[model samples]
Target: MDETTIQLLCPECTKDWQASPDDLPTPADMFHCPNCHASRRTSEFMRTDRDLQTLKQLG
Candidate 1:
């Protein structure tokens, strides 16, 4: 399996983090920041600018 890195910006603390896509939770699951410890649904993180454009085009 290939590993992908996804960058996520923290809304609560304004921190940027990089996580592995393979280890990330599915659409029905959630992800937690290893630094600030804030948690949010995986789909919610997909709302990032990088992802938004692609997802929007796909929709």
Candidate 2:
């Protein structure tokens, strides 16, 4: 089976990180960017075509 994962992007720094959805304890949980220390909800991250391509390559 394939593990479900999510990609997180920081609007402030444009940095990104990826992890399993389980890492988020709740729907309201906020993700902090390692690069910029800015935080935002997972839903707020923009999923661009490049991000989709990266996910495909990783998969």
True-structure RMSD, every candidate: 4.7, 6.1
Query: In candidate 1, what are the lDDT values of residues 1-59, reduced to their tens digit?
Result: 85456666766676776665555666447567666777886556663766534433332
Positional deviation of residue 12's Cα in model 2 after best superposition, in angstroms = 0.9
TM-score of 2: 0.57
Error of 2 at 45 (Å): 3.1
**Separate clash counts for every candidate:** 0, 0
- Which portions of model 2 show Cα errors greater than 4 Å? 46-59
Tens digits of per-residue lDDT, candidate 2, 1-59, equal: 98866666677888776766555434345656678777785455535555444444443
Clashing pairs in 1: none
In model 1, where do residues sit more than 4 Å from their true spots? 1-3, 46-49, 52-59
TM-scores, in order shown? 0.57, 0.57
List the lowest-lDDT window of 10 residues for candidate 1: 50-59
Please, what is the whole-model Cα lDDT of each candidate in the order they appear? 0.60, 0.59
